[model samples]
Target: MLHKLNLEHILFLDIETVPEYKDFDSLSDELKYLWADKTKYQRKEDFTPEEFYERAGIWAEFGKIVCISVGFFSFKGEERSFRTKSFFGEEKEVLIEFKNLIESHFNTPYHLLCAHNGKEFDFPYIARRMIIHGISLPQKLNLFGKKPWEIPHLDTLDLWKFGDYKHFTSLKLLTHILGIPSPKDDIDGSQVREVYYEEQDIDRIIIYCEKDTVAVAQILLRLRQEELLSDDEVISV
Candidate 1:
C-alpha cells in the first residue's frame, strides 16, 4: 500500500511547543489551579504542579506551538529531492501560516499529513491549537465525521506497530534501530522548552524540527524499501 502511494502527496512534519507562559508564576491564579488539577495524576507526590509545568507543552491547552517544520518529496524521473519549510513566531501567526499552506497547496482528498506518532500527537495538537486560536481547520485536519479509513493522516509509529496495540516506539529509538541518521544530534524534545524560553534560540529549534521532519520522510522511504535521502537531496527553504 505504501509503495502505491505517491510520496509527493504526503507532507511530512514535526512541531515544537513550549508552555504558554514563561513560568508557573506567570499564569493567572485560576489557570494555576487548573494546571494543578490537570496534571494531578502525572505529577503525583513526586513533583509540584510548578515543577511539572515545564511539560505543559505536551498538552495543547497549556502550551503553544513554537515551530512547525514540514517537508515534501519531489521527483524528476528517477531522482528525488526533499524540500522543507518552517513556520515560527507568535503562536497565532504560526498557526495561520501553517493553515494557509495546508489549504492552499495540500487541500485534496488525496493529500496526507505524515509524522512519527502524528495520529496521537502532532495532528491533534495542531488541530486543538487552531481551535483555541479560532482558526478554521483546513480540510486535511478536520476529521469531524470521517470514518477511520477516510482519514488522510499517516503515522510512522502506527505503521511500525502493525496492529500491536501495546507496542510503542519513540521516533529517536525507531530511527536508531532502523539505521536512519539520528535527528537528535544537537537538541531533543526535552530541551525544546528551555531552548525557546531560556536560550531564545528559535533557529536552533527550527533546525531540530526540520531534522525530525526529514527523518520522518526517511522513515517512510525505508518502509517503502527505497533509498534513504542523502544530505545533498534535502533542501531547507
Candidate 2:
C-alpha cells in the first residue's frame, strides 16, 4: 500500500514553538490563574503549576510557533531531490507565510501534509494558532467536516502505531530504528524555549526545524522501502 503514495504530492513539515512569554511571571493575572487551574491535575502535588510552565510550548493556548519548515520531493527521471524552506520570526508573520504556501501551492485535494505526530501536535497547533491570529485555515489543515479517511494529514507516529492504541513512538526513535540520521543531535524540543528566549537565535531554530521536516520525509521514504536521501540531495531554499 505504501508503494501507491506519490511522494511529490506530500508536503512534510515540522514546527518549533515556545511559550508566548519569556516566563510564567509575564502572564497576566487572569491568564496565570487560568493556566494554574488548567494544569492542576497534570502538575499534581509535587510541582506547582508555575514550575510546569516551561512546557507551555506544547499547548496552543499558551504557546506560539517560532518556525515552520516544510519540504517536498521532486523528481527528474529517476533522480529524487528534496527541497526545503522555512518561515520564521514573529508568530503572525510566520503563520501568514505558511498559510500562503499551503493555500497557493498545495491547495489541491490530493495534496497531503505529513509530520511525525502531526495529527496530535503539529497539525492542531498550527490550526489553533492560525485561528488565534485571525488567519484563515488552509484547505488541507481545516477539518470541519472531513471524515477519518478524508483528512489529508499524515502522521509518522500514527503510521508506526498501526492501530496499537497504547504505542507511542518519538520521531527520534523512529529515525534511529530506520537508520536515518537523527534530527535531534544538536537540540531537542526540550530546549527550544531556552534557545528562543535566552539565545534569541531564529536561524538556529530554523535549521533545527528544517532537519525535522527532512527527517519526516525520510521516514516516509523508509516506509515505502525506498533508498534514503543523501545529504547532497537536500536543498534549502
Candidate 2 local lDDT, 61-121, one digit each (tens): 9999999999999999978899999998889999999999998889898899999999999
Question: What are the lDDT scores of the predictions, listed in order?
Answer: 0.95, 0.93
Residue-level lDDT of model 1, residues 1-237, one tens digit each, is 999998999999999999999899999999999999999999999999999999999999999999999999999998889999999999999999999998888989899999999999999999999999999999899999999999999999999999998899999999999999999999999999999999999999999999999999999999999989999999998
TM-scores, all candidates, are 0.99, 0.98
Ten residues in a row with the worst lDDT in model 2?
Answer: 1-10
Q: After superposition, how far is residue 133 of candidate 1 from its true place, in Å?
A: 0.5
